[model samples]
Target: MRQVLLINKDPDMHSDLNSLFQENNYESVILDEVETGNEALRKVVNDSYDMLILNLDLPNTNMLGLINKLRLLNQDLPILIYSLELEYIFIKRYLTSGVNGYCFFKNGDVGEILDAAVRISTGKWYISQEMVELIVEKALYSKKIDRFDNLDEQEFEILTHLIKGDTVANIAKIMGVHLPTVSVYKTRILDKLRITSLLELKNIIKIPLLSES
Candidate 1:
């Protein structure tokens, strides 16, 4: 039988997953339940588990750090991220961090959740359909931003200041340029970015900075 270490702070989630595993007739047992990342690390180090289902919101340790430590200890263990965070950036980061699968608790159905577990257990990656769509959308949005790469350094600087809620006059003062020069730069940036107004600029610029947070 395959053994799984389920790390989540919510007892109800643990119970639900246990029931789901049993109902699916998976010969897998949740061997341990841990509430925090530190406990998870200690358990995985001392005990044995074929798979790990991890919650991103662990209280006692950073999520990325815990995954890194677990990867160091057992490179072959299948790690599945069970998170409520719907941000594509977070999902992308976890996928890049050696996690074998991802399932959003709120958006994922039971079948997808089970499939994620089964697939990861067999050394395959699994991501929900919604997440795949989100990734694709982000990729397309990134391509749209690439069009503005032709902006000169000063124009790009001005764009950054504009995104940060800087007024045209304020940007001119900061860059030590006349207001008319800044206005011209702003017009050129808007044209290059293919945006018509400041609101559009704000919306377009948000995607590029999503991964930073």
Candidate 2:
């Protein structure tokens, strides 16, 4: 059986992936971390697995460093980035950083993700067809960078949280700000992106490329 390790903060999502993996005759260890950071990296360093499905939006540690360290430790380890945020640039950067595969929670059909795992295990790099189109579209529209670039650091953080489906109150709690503060950031984020509604913002950032079509 193929061995896989999934590092995600959400238990429910991990469970879903675990169930699916079992159905397909793959052995998987689902690490459900409520808040993983550098400490989680320690576990990663010690465990041996055929593949890794990492949540790039993890709140606990320097995600880039974790990937780098993993690469340094085991160059052959196949790493698959899994996240809810499907920003083309982020995916592009991850590709440049040496991930073997990439998939997003919002964008890919569940079957595609399963296929990605199988392909990765077979030493193939697999990016869904829908993600390819999004990457191409974003590249062609490179001139419109400011659509997201105008956001301040805090605004960017807030926007990413929103992309991960955090509500205003949850965002406020996470950011340790008052509800009004999160509301203000949300409004500014929408205005800066020239989107008038939350749904539009979600459409732009949360919906996967496949779902968009």
Highest TM-score model number: 1
The regions of model 2 sitting more than 4 angstroms off are 27-39, 107-109, 138-213
What TM-scores do the predictions have?
0.65, 0.60
lDDT string for model 2 (1-213, tens) is 255666666657666776777787665544334245454456567766677777777763345556777788789988888767567745665676779888876743566667787888788898866578877776685454435656665676677677667778877766667999988988898777777877777675633222121
lDDT score, candidate 2, position 81: 80
Error of 2 at 62 (Å): 1.7
Reference-based lDDT, residue 58, model 2: 76
Work out how many backbone clashes candidate 2 has: 3
